[model samples]
Target: MNAWKMPVAWMSMVALLVGGCNKDEQNVAPTDDNEAITTATLTLVNKAVPTDTVRATIENLNTTADFSKATLNLKANTTYTGTIGLLDKTKTPVVDATEEIREKVNEHLFVYTYSATSGSQNALIVTITDKDTNPAPGPYPVGLSTDMQTGAAGTGTLNVVLRHQPNVKDGTPNPGSSDLDTSFPVVIQ
Candidate 1:
């Protein structure tokens, strides 16, 4: 009778352990999916002269990308107020992905990287001017709007990457998966 009781107790403990592990698995939250972006447009207005504007649009990003207008013609040694617009053209009436990103501002981050072309001395400098509505020790960059400054007359490739951070945004691009990564030709005249 004593041996039988010991065996029953051991089995009950194992069952409880397995059940607890299953409960933890069920309590884990699901991650959000990446946004579908078919087009990305960057509009820059000269800070000193609003009339001097530069616009670059890259369409069909998910399929055969059209980069005809992806060339940015900026003035050298100038500052421009820039805004980015994203779109999902696959939708019937065209869905504005920029609004969706704005709605979940805390979960998205845009990272910009520039590489000067061969023999070019200067590269584009992009500073994100928008912030997410996170609380203290928070309020990270959203990158929908930015201040772009040109150094000198040069050419470079500007890479724009949109990261889907969800609840893990820490003001860095290393926290999440990339939703969009594209490069535009930059020419500062």
Candidate 2:
């Protein structure tokens, strides 16, 4: 039994060494011009919840808050506002979602309205910041690539990072405590 176990362990070690050498390489470079620069300006947008599911205690209004369509044009350097307008099954603003909302937006269409600064500052910036301040109060959209974060800093390609907001005491359903502290990933074009 002892001799057999030694052979088995030695074989396992050799397999592990061989498998480790097969690991994939990182940061592969393009081999050909087939990857020409895409001339047509494109926008890549995405949004996700920090938790797997939302709590039942949340207000319908809060549940409807989506960052799905929020987008920023990398080429145009512009932000467009988005919404998740509700209509009965007929598709109309149930309340007044038709009107532009302040921080209380529903659509996930585009990015936020930003102040254009003309200094030595990095121009091609995208921003995604949060504040309790807005023209009105509710759930204002945040900037993701605004400021210098936009493709302007250097490579227009910026991978987004999501950190949740902390509102834990209000009582929502999540394994992790809910708060503005809990956020998810979103990106711009």
Candidate 3:
């Protein structure tokens, strides 16, 4: 009886030790699938003249034309108020992907890169004017809307990239997978 009791106690202790060491929760958050974005529209309205507006869009999510070209014509050295919207055209009523991005604002980010036709970077000044609070306890700017300013009369490319950054978004465009990336031919005339 004593031998049996000793063996049983040893097995119980071993089980307890192993169970206590089990990793029940993961350090990283579970990944969520990115929304299927079929179209990206950027509407820029002149700040001085409310009626003057220009739009650039990228369409064709279901075909090879996904990387279609868009042109945005603007005045040189002008300031424009811009709003960006994303849509999923596969649904009966095109799903407003911008709303989904707003819901997960903390986990998503939009990065705007500008380059001149002559290959000079930072040709345009793009500043995200709005910000959203994160669930993990911080605030970061989500690029659904922005204030854009043209530097000078030049041709360039404005690249908009939406990044899906679950647990690792720290403002910069360094730590996530690109959800939507599109380039628009920008002419500041």
Candidate 4:
């Protein structure tokens, strides 16, 4: 081959090799977002009263709490059917992350913990009444919705935590990365 022809052949071979080395997107696993939770709203509807509702929204998922802005106040000695809604408010119209969580219920769990005060000994109790069991090997309790009961009239803080525990959820608060950890000031009267 001529000297100029040799260089042209070498360039053509290099181009062919580089073009053939394109990444196989089929083999590349698509990633689900583990973060970017912008809002968490906990809604409680009174089963007895029917008209009463309590909503606690924790905005600014990336910052400190603004208790004055978002709080939950409920009547004492009441049973409230609690529903938690997670959202990625950074989107154009705000996307609901709860559904994505429901799709991965076996790997997700919501935990509700309350701080005890002098007036309200057992201030709050949370029961995982509803569950989502799919993507099989399932029957896991996904606490996107729950039952909440208030003991007595008191003031406390309700902390809600959503954990992503894939394949290691033994019905405990341990073993997972916290998708959202937020608290709301609670008053029962």
TM-score of 4: 0.81
What lDDT is obtained when candidate 3 is compared to the true structure? Answer: 0.84
Model 3 RMSD in Å is 6.1
Residues 69-162, candidate 4, lDDT per residue (tens digit)? 5788888899999999888877888888998887778788888898865466587888887665644555667788888999878988888888
Sort all candidates by lDDT, best to worst: 1, 3, 4, 2
For lDDT, candidate 1 versus 3, the one ahead is 1
Instruction: Name the runs in model 4 displaced over 4 angstroms.
Output: 1-18, 23-33, 134-138
lDDT of 1 at 87: 99
- Runs with alpha carbons beyond 4 Å of true place in candidate 2: 1-123, 128-156, 168-189
**CA lDDT of 184 in candidate 4?**
83
* Per-model TM values vs. the true structure: 0.81, 0.20, 0.77, 0.81
Model 3 lDDT per residue over 63-177, tens place: 5544344688888778999999889898889889999998889888899889898533544799998787865455888998999987668888888999999889888789989
Residues 2-90, model 1: lDDT tens digits: 99999999999999999998885755586439999999999999999999989999999999999999999988889999999999999
Q: Runs in model 1 with CA error above 4 Å?
A: 1-32, 118-122
Error of 2 at 53 (Å): 32
In model 3, where do residues sit more than 4 Å from their true spots?
1-32, 66-69, 118-122, 135-137
Give the range of the ten consecutive residues with the poorest summed lDDT in model 3.
Answer: 61-70
Q: Ten consecutive residues with minimal summed lDDT in candidate 4?
A: 131-140
Winner by lDDT between candidate 2 and candidate 1: 1
lDDT of each: 0.91, 0.30, 0.84, 0.81
TM-score between model 1 and native: 0.81
